[model samples]
Target: MSRNIEIEFKNIVTEEEFQLLLRTFHISKKQFFSQKNHYFDTKDFALKKLGSALRIREKQEQYELTLKKPADIGLLEINDVINQTEANMLMNHSVFPSGEVKDELHKMKFPIDEFFLYGTLQTDRAETEYKNGLLVFDHSFYLGKEDFELEYETIDRDKGEQFFNELLEKLNIKIRYADNKISRLFKVIQGKKES
Candidate 1:
């Protein structure tokens, strides 16, 4: 298991803007990779209510379970690597594995047993280094809906925010409120249930 703090800035962008950023950065199709995030939450969104989330990310034939919780600066992510068998058990049988993430959930007083596979969001993403930060471009699909996003991950918050905003302004891309992937997917799920 591993733990880290994630400090990132994000912005929603239109398809045009997404493509523009790709061209501007000289990112080619070969640079993009696909990953699926299997989100887990209670029916009532207990995790979301606490501003926390859990997911098992499938990338490059490997799976990683991560729990994201609010921290002082960004989010604290507790990650555990799971084998294919463990991944299958979780996705196919709703079995929550035991590990550091499980331990962290217990510490948070979260009902870990109540979490089930809520949904999955898949993204075709490409990332490059920009101004001493990692800049990410994502085209994600979930619950029959799709969106484009730009993300800048950095250790320094103030400088990262400034650089991200400056880049958006320089590209003439109007900033839009962008929720993280899980939240965006959850919103659609809730909307569907309401309608």
Candidate 2:
């Protein structure tokens, strides 16, 4: 298991704007990478109530469990790698891998035994360098919903905020509130269950 601080800015954008940004940055469809996030939380959304998210992301042949929580600079991300069998068990709600991640959640008073797989989100992502930062483009789909987003990752929070806003303004894109993938997926899945 490993822990780290993540500082990234995201802006919601229309598909047209997403395409324009891609073309302007000379990024092509072939450059994108794809990943799937299998999300989990207690049935009552305990993690969501705490403004945290849990997911097992499958990228290429690798699987990682990630927990994200709110922090001063950005989000504090905790990650742990798991094998295919373990990932399958988690997805099937048959097991919870024990380790530092589970220990941390237990510390937060979450009933780790109640965790369950709820939904999955897929993202086609691409990244490039801009102004000493990582510029990212994402098109994600989940629970019959799709959206496009632009992101910038940087150590300089102030410059990142400035650069992200200016870039949006230059592209004539209005910033719309974009919830993180797990939260959005949970809302949709919960609604589905209710209906």
Candidate 3:
């Protein structure tokens, strides 16, 4: 597994603002790609209570298992590349790939047997470099719900925040309180189940 520190500034956007941002940045459909994210958690949201998340992402026929935990800057992400066969097993049979992720889970005191696939999210995304950071545009759908988001990822948190805040103001976009995609998707799934 490979580890990386993710420092990102994220905000929700309306459809009108989404389209405006795309046009403002000159992004096209050709520059975008799609991915399906399968999220896993315990029935009681054990992982969520601990401020952690697990998901297997499918993009271009490749699968990557990612675990995110709270970190000082943003979140610490650990990723493992697995085959389609393993991914299918995870979705169909609730089997997680055996590797650092599993080992780390055990180390973190999470009962491996409790986690299971809970929901899925599909996203159409476009990304580009902006102000020394990677600017990402995402339109995601899950559980009959859809949302648009703008994100900027960079190593320097201070600079990233400054640039991100100013960019929103410059674009005439209102600031929004945004949760991470997985958390938001899980909430939507939970809401659907409750209703």
lDDT of 1 by residue, 1-195 (tens): 999999999999999999999999999999999999999988898988889889999999999999999999999999999988988888778777889998888888877667789899999999999999999999999999999999999999999999999999999999998998999998898899899
What TM-score, to 2 decimals, does candidate 3 have?
0.97
Clashing pairs in 2: none
- The candidate 2 region of ten consecutive residues with least summed lDDT is 93-102
Worst 10 residues of 1 by lDDT: 106-115
Best by lDDT: 1
Model 2 lDDT, residue 107, Cα: 87
RMSD of 2: 1.4
Tell me the spans in candidate 1 whose CA falls farther than 4 Å from its real position: none
**lDDT of each candidate versus the true structure:** 0.93, 0.88, 0.92
TM of each candidate vs. truth: 0.97, 0.94, 0.97
lDDT comparing candidate 2 with the true structure = 0.88
Arrange candidates by lDDT, highest first: which order?
Answer: 1, 3, 2
lDDT of 3 by residue, 101-176 (tens): 8888989988777788888999999999998889999999988899999999999999999999999999899999
